[model samples]
Target chain A: MKLFFLLTIFFSFVPILYAQVDTTTLQNNLYDILEDATTDKEGVEYYDLVEYLVQNKIAVNTASIAELMKIPNIDRQSAIAIVRQRNLLGGIKNENDLRSAEGVSEELIDRIISYLIFGDVKDVSFFDSINKNFKAIDFTLRSRGIYDLQQDKAFSDGKYYGSSWKIYNRFVVSKDKNIRVGVLIEKDPGEKSFNDFTTFHFYARDIGFIKNFVAGDFLFEFGHGLTLWSRYSISKGIETVGILPRNGKGIIPYLSSDENMSLRGAAVQFSFNNFNFYTFYSVRNLDGSIDKSTNQITSIRLDGLHRDSSEVAHQRIVNEKLLGISADYSFGEIGSVGLLYYNSTFENDFQHNSLLDPSGNSFDYFAGSYSFTFGKLYFSGETAYNKISLATINSAEIAVDKNFSLLFSYRNYPYDYWSLHSNGFGEKDGTQNESGFYSGFKWRTSYGNIYFYYDQFKYPIGDEKLPLAIKGNEFLIYYSVKPFRDTEFRLRYTNQLKESVAAINGEYGVLSRRKDNLRTELLYKLSKFIQMRSRIELVKTYATAISSEEKGLLLFQDVKYAPTASLSFSGRIVFFQTDSYDSRVYEFENDLTGVMSNPALYGDGMRWYLVARYNTSFGLSLSMKYSELIKPNEKTMGSGDTLINRNVDNRLSFQLDFKF
Target chain B: MNLTIYQLYFWLGADLKFVKDLVFSAAVKKEIGFNPSIRLGTEYSMVDFFKLRIGTSNEPNTYSGGIGIIYQFVQVDYAFFSHPDLGLTHQFGLIIRFTKN
Candidate 1:
């Protein structure tokens, strides 16, 4: 019920046009919060939330369960208890109000206090915010250039039309919720034209009964992502019980530079009392390769690259039309339920049946989801049907006390069930054809904290007859301790037995692949201006009853320095060696402001990078990065068109930011 | 009178260098009318910035450990000793010195 006018006022606080406040403290704090949430799969997309929060911090006194759940570590039970506590006490007065909540832990409150506004709150309309600040028309423009020092095979053959330079430009202008516009244009290194990819959006919210309206391009998500989901959904990582639910945010304009995955048409939302309705329609031409004789698609290209003649032939070969609607009803603090239905039709049929991709020309899906909270227990689930097949997931989270919590979830997706725009929880992508049982627990002990999870899965061999009936299991145990006021030590170990189809004795059989990983990390804050991180990881993978095995070792140290208010630097040096590509280790690097890089390293090589940022008082920011990969005995690297003929490879990137 | 009730304990240690990063030390302690305690310890310099040490004594059965973080002209040290009857004791110290020629 708090979604009516608060959302309109939320978007009114548009992105600040300044250079991230031109302070050393803000730069250091942003890195510390995001480092815990980032891995290989989550990088640039997570920056959207941090960027918005830096400018507009939500008032903790008036935040609802939906708003509280948007934070990184808050789970369903904690959010429900917090909202209930806030309503009981009229308004939160201080940290003591947060401590009195049933499920809020001491450690949890301390971590999230930095991103909250403790000042008193007063409800204000969207027009009142406009009247309060007349100079709120914020505009920002950014441009970046990236260049490679070594020449690749694509440049030697002259098959590429563009220079060996990648260019990106974007700008956004907004004033309140009534007027907001954003445009992004980019060109890859070997693209033919200057602006090979472009996307734009126009959005307006909270006018009369219209909660939201968007044209050009937009995105919407509902339920636990068993149906439709946004690009930045929750995935399994170090956090166990805290990341179980997707916390789907409904119908927002897409403001990213990614070329594909966003709908290009119109979407609208309307609210009346406790009921909300959302509807959207999109029709776009996508890139694919089609069989001329059969008029069917061979494969779809999602990379959005047209560097050569072959890639150009696969550009915009098929048209797809989609329509969807969702209706949600809320019962104050008790519970909520939603129902969704969407249909899509493509111009051409799919030639292959991978079971992971959607087949045929026309398809329809209907789903229902609900969430109920009572006392310290919370429950949520979603179930979807696509004509002949069904997919479902049910989960429950319980907070036993202030220091302990438990979670259990069971999911079953038939092998024939498929979704074109869905992302759910499973070992595979969106639980294509898998059934699993997962249980996790988090405990806060006197000395430290403990987090552990266990999962077992199976892929059924039914009438369709998959290659192999596989059974697998995995477990993770993590321990973290604070030995001193400024030092933290963490240790984590994970083991997984993945059963897959392989050739054994010249026949199709199951190969039980076991992977074991152990990681030890330390974080120390020496002083106000210096921070350090040290880590060591070991990985071993082997097949049961097989002689072949692979091992990998990685060691890295990071140092961040903020000597002055206007200047800061971050650097890292990594040493890694793996037996083959299958045993390679991934490391997230310190990159430019809006850029994140996670590269998989194998063989014997050393990689290092340094990023520097300088902000001026006149609202201009300059950023530069230099990185190199050095291998002693390797004369050639990479494969196919991206291969290089040198032992050392380096790259250079620089960006400029201007605001008014 | 004080010497009869409490024993005056003293220990001496000898350092053995294995490499630039790995080192070992052995020590012996003596008290009046009691068995001498023999202790062996090792210290490893994991990097230029960190040092770790651990030691165990035979008599009275006590274990002691310490860690050092060296950054520029300042160094921070933390030591903890676990006694058989005295529970756990923690000590912290900071040292700052400038190198001069």
Candidate 2:
């Protein structure tokens, strides 16, 4: 016992005695050295001198972004970057180590070496190495329901109501400060539907190089709703209507968001004079079985009701190739401008079977856009021009989109082909023109936005037999109110009038059509994890072509719930109604009878669905959806009678994406 | 995570500013930037006759690639991203890394 106590006592006193040892002598010496170094440079800036010492291997300290900026030739942004990197690294060990820092340059290191010192002491740990890089595998799956509800619901008439599912996977590899690589794959599964899956165009969309040269299908964007882009698929309902040009299907070397399912092509981009230039080319080929209509106007029956393949073999068509080029220039504070041009040829599988041009047609298209910022306001504009055969039309728009700015626009479209008279006896010869003028005012605040607008449009036809003269004026009022960060209430009321003008024969043109619509929507984002949305629309239309005036209502609601960072659930409901025989005008039906007769006149209907999605850090995601569609009944079709039909569709999809 | 190497001088010396203001008894404002100083660094004494370097400061990072008459630093790297529908997304870039003394 006595020996143990004495040993403890001795150890305790040893620490005290060691601590008591006179460090004053060493401190005095250090003071003397510091005093001398300071006297060597008195008038110079402290930071400048600090860099000098650091360069000379004198002192070491964890430098902040602000501290880095004090060095010559470094900018504020670079300084901030250095600070962020320092945090990421925990702390730099020495001045030379700063080379690995984001903004540190070797030249700056050499220049500052004359004065810097590496004397700071620090601790190191194993965890530091683990944070240097990241690598992971990602996957995604998605399913969608595609349908046109405006067709008749009779079994004799074929209308496609089905769902499509796709699967995707991606693998990513990341190493050391600035290098990464990824690989991905995708496939789609077709579901049973009235329309057979004969032409499912599936191809590798984005397998290529990043940053320098890309050799695969990739998403690209060049202008404000112009040129080409991938995310245009999820456009609004207005965009769904032919009032606007449909987004093209192709790929090119361009800038865009949403990498999945886009155009395919090989492209290269380079930077010069602070501007980036890019170009790309894409190839496409489509072939499928064709179903012929027995009659042009009546008794058109579609076959292959249960067959997976087409009954008739159509002519083989050569591959259709499209080529496009784009260039963009960006200068800080000055804004950006981009231009694009594309050309493609349309071909027919049959040499002389088509009623129209059997050789098909080709069009040359060009688009240009520019965006600039002045103070708190932004100005943007774009123009798209297409030349078809002997006719050319230019569509241009300019928007001064600023806080509380007014917008005005004008459009003119001339149809040179309208001069071709196909009275069934001979070719009709006359030109038709469509023109419009629009002006609007918008008031925007942090909470919401309010807009009011007026638009006038006119269509003039020169053919005496085609008595086509129509004038239209419309007034719109729209507003969205946000009570909270993620919640909004929106309302839109549109009043429109259509008046018949003088016919080619100078007789009073008959009033063709008139329509009005009111729409209301509510969107509530409870948080980043949950959201709910609801919309209601009502329409009333009058037309001399139909016996009765038509009125319809549509209601839709959806809820999205995200329980975790990578998983989401969504459910939707819809109910709609419209005239059964007016599919050519207001396709608001469940079946696609009208669409079968004229695909251009897509029918309308109501649908409900539920979907689930999962996403991973490595750029992978998956989704599954089940949808029920309601259509009109065609089994007992009669004049002015409504059709009722129902369809259930189930789809599964998976996707994987990786960014190198 | 940081790995830095440097040296310091432990000697008494008067800076130019201190000497100039000595008569006025003005407070010495210590400077922090590069000052003229002699430095010793690790070098391959047996292999080189002599090595001289010229550089400018670009702040946080510096422009540092060098053209070496007897020594050279070069690197090549390639990266790729693969997709099921699309084949391979790839990038090829070369970096010529160098240091001078």
Q: How big is the positional error of residue A236 in model 1, measured in Å on the Cα after superposition?
A: 1.6
- Top model by lDDT, which number? 1
Q: Which runs of model 2 end up more than 4 angstroms from their true locations?
A: A1-212, A218-265, A287-318, A337-402, A416-434, A445-448, A458-475, A483-487, A496-511, A522-535, A544-547, A555-569, A572-608, A612-623, A629-660, B1-101
Docking level for model 1: incorrect
Highest DockQ: which candidate? Answer: 1
User: Per-residue lDDT for A435-549 in model 2, tens only?
Assistant: 5666666566676666676777776552344446667777777777866556567787766666554333455555656677787766666566666665656677776644448
Using all chains and alpha carbons, the TM-scores for the candidates as numbered come to 0.81, 0.45
**Per-residue alpha-carbon lDDT of candidate 1 for residues A279-369, written as tens digits (9 for 90 to 100):** 9999988888899998888787767887888888887787889999999887756777999999888988977656455678888989998
What DockQ, between 0 and 1, does each candidate earn?
0.02, 0.00
